[model samples]
Target: MEEILGILTQLGLTEYESKAYISLVSLINAKADEISKNSGVPRSKIYPVLENLEKKDLIKIKQGRPLEYHVIAPEISLKNYEENIIHNIHILQQKLTRIYEEKLPHVNTPIITVEGLDKILKKEYEIIKQTKKILYLRIGFILPSEIENIKKALNKLINNGIKIRILAVEECEIDGKVVSIRDIFEDMDVEIKYKQLPSAQLIIRDYKEMFLVFAENSGMSISNSNMVGLFNTYSVIISNYLSAFNKQWSKL
Candidate 1:
């Protein structure tokens, strides 16, 4: 059947090889000419297809006046193929991991300047999504429109077993219902503290990377304001900011 042939091809058999195998499975021990007639493969191609199948251990060749091809049991043949694939994947993982570890110490400091509120928020969302161990955030304020997205990102991080620590200036309310950002993370077991609004906005992840945004006019709506920020993994700068954040957190 076409479907069986398709499945056989997906399992690493060439189309001609799959057809020839299927034909030989039905015929048991058949000469190349008979296999070519049943499988619809050209007689010239059937010999090469059988040879390849024999090489792959999917078929056995019988010595006789005219050579005959017989299909190997699918269970044995397919299981061997699957095991080979998994073994190769494991070997690839080991080699790639070694290369990754070798280059990690030589990695350079990367400082990227992202402009515009939208661009900064986009980068923030990306960084938050990649959070692993810990996320430290100082929120002066977030736009009402962006709150939902930010909450979603935080929730995803929490689900991934990343611990979160947040410091904020004040609470926000929508439609007369108080929206406590901390309350959203209540069951997630994150630490939330309140403080007088800091002059700059900060987001640090895993104590290794940071983003700092400074606005020209503090009173202007954050969504519409022009903001400048650096997103970087410069270790010394990150360490200093982490220390400052810890100092500020201690006060709260």
Candidate 2:
């Protein structure tokens, strides 16, 4: 059947080999001429196909007055093919991972700037998702609209074994309306401290990358009020930010 031949082809059998094997399975101990006739493969091609199948252990040959070909049991042939595919994939994985690691250091770090509340929030979420070890936040205040989304992203990082430290201004409140930082993250296992209300907003990940927001009342409203942020991965710049954060943290 065409469908059976297609499945065999997908399993790494040549079309002629699949046809010859199918024909031989139907006619046990079929000779080359009979297999070609039944399978519609050329007589000249059928011999080579049979030889290839024998080499793959997919068929057995009987040598008498004329050679005959018999199909291997489907269960045995299919299981062998599956095992070989898995083995090859395992080898490729190790080789490819090594190549990726060797090339990773030469890759350039990206610097991006995002504006508006929605875009900034989305970029922040992406950075948090990529954090492998630690997430550091210094906020002047929290916006009511963005709190839920921020909480979800930070919770996901925390669940993935990332440590989180949040430093907020002394009067840090949600939208300057209600709910303090302590109230929002009370149930979460993150370090929270109050500083002398920093004018800048920062989010650092792994001490390698950071996002700095500079806009008046940046985290208060969802309005597109020139709330600009710079995303950088330069190691020295991030290290300087880390140093400042540590100094601010110690004084709190």
| Best of the candidates, TM-score | 2
Where does candidate 2 stray beyond 4 Å? 1-110, 170-179, 218-224
lDDT (tens digit, per residue) of candidate 2 on 211-243: 997656545432235678898877777888899
- Model 2's TM-score against the true structure: 0.55
- Give the per-residue lDDT of model 1 (tens digit) for 65-92: 7997777787898788789878988999
Q: Could you tell me which residue pairs clash in candidate 1?
A: none
TM-scores for all candidates?
0.54, 0.55
Model number with the top lDDT: 2
Candidate 2 CA-lDDT value:
0.79
Worst 10 residues of 2 by lDDT: 217-226
